[model samples]
Target: MFKRVIWIGGGVVIGVVIAAKAEAYVRANTPKSAREFVLGTDQDHVAERTLSSLWGQFRTIMDSREEELNRRYIDRARSARH
Candidate 1:
């Protein structure tokens, strides 16, 4: 019975030590941005804000490209008509 208790206690201690080490390793290796995104108060809106900003930039670029393409096509058609 004493031997069994000692084994159980040793197992519990080892498990705890392993868990702590794992937690520390993860914390140390985690990226700062990821940690901030996870733990920040603005976590809920971070993704939404990021996506919105990205979408806005994409739209702006798309519009600019479309305008350039249309201008080029019109110019080419005009030149061909001459």
Candidate 2:
């Protein structure tokens, strides 16, 4: 009787844990915004927005790095010659 009770309790705990994990997984994958819900926006729109933002950031970083390289090399060389 004690062994059976222990087994049942263990099963219940495992079931609860599995259910909680599934809920979390679903929530994490679903979109969170009211606008998205109203607009019926899909995953593709979310991905495109993310990619566009990332591209903008990349361009900003690239421009800054190019300016730094020009200052470090071209400006220094010109100053040395003068």
Candidate 3:
């Protein structure tokens, strides 16, 4: 009975210690913000760069003529407002 109690108490303490260590390890390793680790550390103009990077990568799937068509459509839409 006494030995079982000691074992349970020791197990709980060990578990707590392991959790604290793991949390510390993760805090030390992981960045607070994703942008700091991925695109850049700077926060300025992130949305534009993020959109451009994704759109540029997606544009690679289309052929040259398709890309030109897309550009013309986008430009015409912009020009139509003037």
Task: Find the candidate with the highest lDDT and give its number.
Answer: 1
Candidate 1 lDDT over residue span 1-82, tens digit each? 9999999999989986885675466558888786565545564455477668889999999999999999999999999999
Q: What is the C-alpha local distance difference test score of candidate 1?
A: 0.77
RMSD of 3: 19.2
lDDT of 3 by residue, 1-82 (tens): 9999999999989986885675456557777674356436654555577669879987786667798999999999999999
lDDT values of the candidates? 0.77, 0.73, 0.73
| Total residue pair clashes for candidate 1 | 0
Q: After superposition, how far is residue 39 of candidate 1 from its true place, in Å?
A: 9.0
Residues 6-65 of candidate 2 have per-residue lDDT tens digits of 999999899868856754565577666744563345633554665688899999999999
TM-scores of all candidate predictions against the true structure? 0.50, 0.47, 0.39
Model 3 residue 48 CA deviation in Å: 39
Error of 3 at 27 (Å): 0.5
Candidate 2: the clashing residue pairs are: none
> What lDDT is reached at residue 44 by model 1?
42
When summed lDDT is taken over every stretch of 10 residues in candidate 2, the lowest stretch is 38-47
C-alpha RMSD values across all candidates: 18.8, 15.3, 19.2
